[model samples]
Target: MWLLKKLSPDFKTIADFRKDNRGAIKRVCREFVLLCKKRDLFGGELVGIDGSKFKAVNSKKKNFNEAKLLCDIYSVLFLMI
Candidate 1:
């Protein structure tokens, strides 16, 4: 963290540093994706897709689709009215 702090002299906050380096972050992500593709890290099999259990710390619920999101928002708005 201190080494990263030394590297940036203009930014006062971590958020500021991240905002300034957004392009660099994007470039790094693109390069990482290319590298993964080149190395065939995806293990091309149907079995590979369902073998993970990574979820957010707060929610047992998986990601929401458009309908679920609309329903949730409508319910909240209905309650407020």
Candidate 2:
């Protein structure tokens, strides 16, 4: 527990930080990945980006694809609120 606590930050801190610098952080990450691609860092590689996150109440079989994912996650979060 001690090690985990030491290595990981609380969710509030992470959330606050992300909210403050979300756009800048995303721009920097995108630039970094573009640089890597230009430099052939992932030579002949097929990259797949899935930004979907499954909610707790949603079954695994139903949680495929971006459109369905957004609906499921938002529905659960809205219900919680």
Candidate 3:
């Protein structure tokens, strides 16, 4: 804590450190995973990874309700017909 306070590096410095030591960091993470596996620390039953990304839309034009969804669906079906 004291060391961090003394040398409070900015975002660029931290980013540079990460870029330079990426390989070392990956090796360290791999070794940690291996150690955990040896100890049967991970449950292989279920793993959930959420990588879903959603766009930010706050405008009224982009907002919708159940009525709006049904109307849009009907419009699309009508267009097809």
Q: Pick the candidate with the highest lDDT.
A: 3
Instruction: Quote the positional error of residue 81 for candidate 2 in Å.
Output: 59
lDDT value for candidate 3?
A: 0.93
lDDT-best of 2 and 3: 3
lDDT of 1 at 61: 72
Instruction: List the candidates' TM-scores in order.
Output: 0.39, 0.45, 0.53
- What tens-digit string does per-residue lDDT give for candidate 1 at 30-53? 999789979999776665366678
Which segments of model 2 are wrong by more than 4 Å? 1-8, 49-81
Q: lDDT per residue, candidate 2, 9-77, as tens digits?
A: 789999999999999999999999899989988777676789988566656785588987898899999
The alpha-carbon lDDT assigned to residue 70 of candidate 2 equals 94
Rank by TM-score (best first): 3, 2, 1
Question: Candidate 1, which segments miss by more than 4 Å at Cα?
Answer: 1-12, 44-81
Regarding TM-score, does 1 or 3 come out ahead? 3
* TM-score of candidate 3 on Cα atoms, chains taken together: 0.53
lDDT minimum window of 10 residues, candidate 2? 54-63
The local lDDT score (0 to 100) that residue 54 gets in candidate 1 is 73
The lDDT of model 1 is 0.82
